[model samples]
Target: MEIIHHHNLAMKTEEEKLPPLIQAIAAREIAGFDNANNLHLHDLKISILDANEEQKQVSISMPSSPIEVHVGSSTLYPMSDSAAKFHSQPIPNNNKLKYQRFDSFKTWSGKLERQISNLRGKPCEIHENDDIENLPLDRFFDALEGPELDTLRASEEIILPENEKWPFLLRFPISTFGICLGVSSQAIMWKALATSDSTKFLHVTPEINLALWLVAAALVAAVSAVYSLKVIFYFEAVRREYFHPVRVNFFFAPLVAVVFLAIGAPPPVAGKLHSAAWYALMAPILCLEVKIYGQWMSGGQRRLSKVANPSNHLAVVGNFAGAVLGAAMGLKEGPVFFFAVGLAHYVVLFVTLYQRLPTNETLPKELHPVFFLFVAAPSTAAVAWTEIRDSFDHGSRIAYFIALFLYFSLAVRVNFFRGFRFSLAWWAYTFPMTGAAVATMKYADAVPGAGTRLLAVTLCGVATVAVAALLVATVVHACVLKDLFPNDMAIAISGKRPKMTRKWRHRYRRRSSSSSSTTDSDYCQGN
Candidate 1:
């Protein structure tokens, strides 16, 4: 072993230049060192499954091959004297830290984390998992057959790899940045890349323009995330007072669903149906509201009336905000489709906003004010797009439809999740709908562009596998609906609780009118 130090970029030092003291630190993963996911803490002897080009050519690879590495503990693998010394130090106990049983290598570490963490009975499974542990060098090398192998040599210096990169410590920064213009840049980034403009020439402003696109994408990604967070927070905040009757109840869920249906809705019959599909959006909102707010109607009227829930009111604000944002983003880049997509979304929001009807046909002061302002968000979003649609390209329009689905589906249930918990069946279908939207944008006869139309397809495929893995796990008590508000569900549909059961009616008729209330209360004590 030998050692060499350099002060300039062009300098080189081979492994032979390091002394044994330094060489000891450079050996491939040593037993008891960190593993890929930081899930387990243990050490194992290495066996080469593959090697990188540089490693294949080298007499010895960095973190000398065939050495054991630790899993739960931190250790230096560079073999540098400084790193070796760094690895040898002992770490203190952290009661708060828990780890999963990491297999040490896999493409979907998040799933692995979820599985293992569940096995260990926890959510997040890392304590102090910061360590440059090495995997079997050969296996690691064999995996990187593309430019992604070294694509981010410089970026990885500070940022670790997500599934977006190799190894799984890095996460797609959804939380770090917030939404700005509308829709996250990830969707917009795909739109931009797929829709190449003649203006994007190589000799002209390629570098400058490309940089702008990337920066713009990062900003949008941040914005979309923030928008999601904001919507969910608002929903949760508004629902604080009412936790019964599944009050909010999928306020915007069906909207994502309609985006997919839009593809199939292209036929003349389909067009009329999809165009008029606003009825589907009206059901849940109108039903829930009639139950919640329209309780005072007379017998005949109550039978026909309904009430709206508190959280849905808030969702009206959040989801419509998203629709506006989505349409706005597509406005400049797309045309007819953006407006059409937005109009479709506005229908959903409008339905949700005024979902309730009075049982007795009597007007409530709150309904007009809440529904009016609530309707404003989607209305403004819709009109904005309709007015600007001519300037937007068809590609933007298609993307806008997909954007509508993603925004409406992702966070709607968090506030109103009851019977419709994390439904894999829902996501499985929704994902493909999103993909179809990307395709519609890609092939919509507007500007020509290439897109990862297959990205969402691939995701849909993955989701299929995931659904199989999904378990019917329910934590919240289903009885909350009955226990908290026994009449809510019935009220939503019938505009009133079902007429007292036949037996109760018969018994009440036989009882004295004066004691009717007391006798009925005793008869249905639990309810």
Candidate 2:
């Protein structure tokens, strides 16, 4: 538990004969247990009050979890009498310095080997927390050496496991989607949709600007309604016990949820879509971890425990990048509104699959078919609309169909080639999910002249039964796995029951008020 900056300090605990010059911290302060034998230590608290200017000696100690703070300024050199002298800076007498990594140390570590590189240097002065939620520590260290890292300590509540840094080790892909959402295709589509609808525009109003606003709001509202309803339905599935927030997303995923209105915030900054979605996707994950952290901090409200992993967070990063790509391509030709809405729907599909996989947790053989549904979902959504749009206007040359056809087919083959085996149940479940996407196309198009009309309906029917069965089976499975649940599935009940919980608390308080009054009277009479 002796946390030292340079590799000059061996991993061995306090083996030196001389007392540390500063003794800035002690082992007992950080790890309360005399766990001098454990592989790694936690509870990294060190007091560095003993810096001796005359001796140029300093010491710092912290658990090697969350962050590894390295003090580049400190230096150690071997003495003639089997002792090591410590210095605050590179010794002038010996211009050559040693660079330490973990255990062993090498001599002279010349300027080039010991050189520091900061490619993504901060242009402006480092603000207190310009990007608290997205600290980008690697970028920070890349900009400054170990000594400078101390100046950039974060105030944000980072929730990563041991040996990681918040905003840096976190795998959330917020920037990508946030940027995409900021420059949302839906916005452009509404503008185009209005311009294209010349007849309606002419009929609308005397004021040209007013008419423009109406069209913009109408199309925006239409697409927004679609995505909002999507969120509602997906959550309702969980509310109805079809999805378990904890069991599905037991690990902290990144923020992948596009919760535009939930926090009532402005459109995310460019490049933040990916990061935001990662954070959103991991919202449940983080809260779940917070519960673990809470129990530990509170000395165990419950003796039971929940294992932590970063599966969903990694998935959010992957999917946020993926969702953005799907959105950009999906909207390239069709009404951007349709493309964004379609991509948003695909997000729902991912949220479901994400419920099953870790953010980057390797896929299990049993979940192989899941990849088909994974590849097929966005591809199919992109294709379904293109198929309809193509049928109505033979002249329509939108290449969505070709792109989706090629992309998904290639993706599926890649997954299979990668040797990810799917269980028979996956085939049984996914083909139906695939069928639902097929059937979903027909529901939107019933025109007589449409070439894809009948085929769409046929796919719709097949997918309907498949999706229904999958939904039923999924819901049952989500509810039945109590071990997967937080507090035995507390994530489910804790998720949507926040308000209901408040109401129940109020009711309990009211009843307690009267019961206490009666008890007081009885006590007085007894007295």
472-516, model 1: which lDDT tens digit per residue?
Answer: 121122133212111111111111122456775665455434344
TM-score winner among the candidates? 2
| Cα deviation of 126, candidate 1, in Å | 55
Q: Please, what are the lDDT tens digits per residue for candidate 2 over residues 137-237?
A: 23332221111111111211211122422121011111112222211222322222223222232242324333333443443354345434433433322
Which residue ranges in model 2 land beyond 4 Å of their true spot? 1-370, 373-391, 394-458, 483-527
Lowest summed lDDT window (length 10), candidate 1: 485-494
C-alpha lDDT score of every prediction, in listed order: 0.31, 0.31
How does model 2 fare in lDDT? Answer: 0.31
